[model samples]
Target: DNIWGAVALHNFIEMLRSFFQPVNVHVTIADGNITLKNDALLEILKA
Candidate 1:
């Protein structure tokens, strides 16, 4: 049961990581390009 619980927790963490990966990418991109902030905001809004 403990092993299964660990596996479940790992899966949950992986899911969260995948979920936020795109947001992190967008943030990095926006930080790199001040001029693209408007475009990035629009893309985020559309998403």
Candidate 2:
């Protein structure tokens, strides 16, 4: 175990968010807008 584990995880999450967010994408939840991660799945559902 290392002290950088949390920092590493935080970096990974930020990378994942950047990778997933190619489009100007959002989902309309009852509470508020949420980012939709899966582009292919969204396209399939839209069809």
Candidate 3:
């Protein structure tokens, strides 16, 4: 599906960014849902 493909691309971008970034940015699927979790993202979410 297109949604899954988009998620894959997003995850790939995040993975590449993680190399130069400090925070561990990554994505995964949980219970048929997309889960994007990372310290940088967490902080943004908390703000």
Candidate 4:
């Protein structure tokens, strides 16, 4: 059940990523590194 739960969440994240445009989200770039807000990274981390 635990494994299934993780899988389900992973799949949901993947679906969301497919539907959502990353480019639409704002990001900051400095020192040759792209920085995104915590919420943005959290969203990607979900996958």
> Which candidate comes out best when scored by lDDT?
3
lDDT (Cα, tens digit) per residue for candidate 4, span 1-47:
24565488668767767789454443333423433346454455445
Error of 2 at 8 (Å): 0.3
**What is the model-wide C-alpha lDDT for candidate 4?**
0.53
lDDT by residue for model 2 (1-47), tens: 13364367458667767999655544333313323366554454345
Q: Which stretches of candidate 1 lie over 4 Å from their true place?
A: 22-47
Candidate 3, residues 11-47: lDDT per residue as tens digits? 8778788777756655443433544445455444345
- Per-model TM-score, in order, reads 0.42, 0.38, 0.40, 0.43
lDDT score for residue 5 of model 1: 48
Candidate order by TM-score, highest to lowest? 4, 1, 3, 2
- In terms of lDDT, model 3 sits at 0.57
Count of clashes, each model: 0, 0, 0, 0
* Native-to-model Cα distance after best TM-score fit, residue 6 in candidate 3, in Å: 0.2
lDDT, each prediction: 0.51, 0.50, 0.57, 0.53
Clashing pairs in 1: none
lDDT of 1 by residue, 1-47 (tens): 24564477568667877987654332222344334425545465346
